[model samples]
Target: MARPGVPAPPPEPPRVGITLQQLRQSQGLSLDELSRKAGVSKSMLSQIERNQANPTVAVVWRLATALGVGVGELLGDGRPAPPAIVTVPAHGTPTLKSPDGKCELRILGPIDLAGEFEWYELTVQPGGALESEAHEPGSREHLSVLAGTLEVSAGSDTSRLKAGETARYAVDLPHAIRNTGKTIASALLVVLHAA
Candidate 1:
């Protein structure tokens, strides 16, 4: 089975059809609804959920974002979380880049806190910005600037924070963080979810 100068194909990702279908149903989302939310075609989603097709990474990411779950969760065994202190090394943390690719958010929270709360180490390149949609009602976000300056806008209000400064605001409405400074900006963001 060895081919000269040829690499073996990568193994397939875990089948996620059943898990995707179950999650959609549990969330009371119809194929059309999920399609609209995830920006994927209904036919493609149907195919993926039926295991008829292996989705691309972009598709999986869109679906995961719509489902409010991580890609790992989508591909993982659905198991109840066990009580334990989780440690994530900097290099091992998952990072998501903004659509523009100018900002990066490193997930710094444990998996168990996924939907309820999250912590992120956010890095914004000069003139970069991270915009977010509205979260669940009563959700709040706290940001502590570690370097440079940041401009934060929540709903109709906007504020600026410099290094060593902190800002807390309601995130139930649209929010954004922009690095208006010439240098790169880094910050720690903590999101507290509503019960």
Candidate 2:
């Protein structure tokens, strides 16, 4: 709704646009190949490559992983030279939410290390659960509670951790991080994939 003399604001442009075509071409991957590898539709991949459509962070993550490149590279931020320090503002970091919307995972690790080694700040609202399917064989996770309490279940085993406590367990089987407390629970999670 608009006021008597007020006009509606213009629609915002898509957030993601980068050198996707160049990266795909350099890797000798056709749209179909990349689509299959990234689990994206061919049309969507084409649109993204042509900068005709914007992809969500999850899509960007998948594409970067499929291309074996960093998210920064996909975003056209090439690291031609090593810098002494690189800082990313908090607001610039990507975050993923669980389907139920009660759990949030702030991606803290670089996309380039996604499959091999990754970390995230996990936040779960009371009574929320971050259920996860089995990861790669021999995969493991280390979680250190930062606030409140969290219950972790790996396979048939379960453990509870409070602030300042850590738990390490295999992620090769189905697992879950649950906040049974009345308050939100946060933890620093690190994942390591087998070579």
Candidate 3:
């Protein structure tokens, strides 16, 4: 309850689950068709839609890429999609969302498609998770935890990365980056592309 002089806190943000369904529907694809394209099980996809399951970042990325959308689209605000070519300035770049809803992403630089890979910084709030779906073929990712602790899940493996620790995994493996620590967390993600 708000005091007469104090204002009430903002309402909780809506939970974001399986915005993937929106992507699938927008693309006119059946769950099975999307399953085939994303290499995710239809049952799993169904669970994700219903919020019964949380897909790893790899799985999430793959689905988004198959749908030809940004990872944010799969984990999103359900807004109308804009044109191709998303240009984010040094100060105003779009974010890669965390499903746990406790983190904020800052896009620091341009996506260098000309190079073999790109990098981004992710700042995680206490109890936040960034579940990035899988990426396209031949792509991989490398992450280094900068502060606090993080839970890194890739494919069937899951590990905790403390400060200064790093791990690299295939982008096709459903992956998730989660802040398991009580304090704030940050990480550097290096995305590598396949030739």
Candidate 4:
């Protein structure tokens, strides 16, 4: 059913491509103003929009609130489609070996979360580690140990996450992931950001 002057609906946006940037710009906001209003770091918001990083739910909430939108607005209805999960291809296995020989993170789907953050699967070699330097503000993160054991260190606090165990924290926590058990370890990571 096409209207007289209206064209057919264009293809749907991939899950992550719908970022807050589009939403904010639609409302006529500048990055600096949005950062100040949302209380998130300007750099971080830029990263999220560029799909340069993943953000957490909490950070999503902040941006949404500041924008007068709902968290669902960020994740969207999964609609135009629906809540869907995408996996990486075998040939796409990441060549990003860990410098610490500890762990490697392979992004599973579109890092953009379309309005949210990117999600990934982290594979940690026994005694492996995941590290990253400080990033922009308004970024949130979550982790779930799917198989094996994972030791997560955030600042001065440490948490041992076991199989089927899950945890969520602020990306500002300055954390790292390590595998202490025998055998390879894997987990799911969801990152939300202002971008």
Model 1 segments more than 4 A misplaced: 1-86
- Expressed as tens digits, the lDDT of each residue in 111-193 for candidate 1 is 79997999999999999999999999999999999999999999999999999999999999999999999999999999999
Clashes of each: 0, 0, 16, 18
lDDT of 4 by residue, 41-77 (tens): 9998888778676667788888888977767767774
**What would the per-residue lDDT of candidate 3 be over residues 1-195, giving only the tens digit for each residue?**
899999899975433354766667767899899899999999998988777887888987888888888777666775537545555566576676655568766655565553476777888897788776787777888889999999988888998989999988887767888887899988888888787
Best prediction by lDDT: 1
What RMSD does model 1 have?
Answer: 20.2
lDDT of 2 by residue, 89-170 (tens): 9998999999999999999999999899999999999999999999999999999999999999999999999999999999
Query: Order of all candidates by TM-score, from best down to worst?
Result: 2, 1, 4, 3
TM-score of 2: 0.59
lDDT (C-alpha) at residue 81 in model 4 = 31
| Candidate 1 clashes between residue pairs 3 or more apart in a chain or in different chains | none
Clashes of 3: 16
Instruction: State which candidate, 1 or 3, has the greater TM-score.
Output: 1
User: Where is model 4 more than 4 Å wrong at Cα?
Assistant: 1-88, 93-95, 111-116
Pairwise TM-score winner, candidates 2 and 4: 2
Better of 1 and 4 by lDDT: 1
**What TM-score does prediction 4 earn?**
0.50
Listed per candidate, the RMSD to the true structure in angstroms reads: 20.2, 19.5, 23.8, 20.3
TM-scores of all candidate predictions against the true structure: 0.56, 0.59, 0.48, 0.50
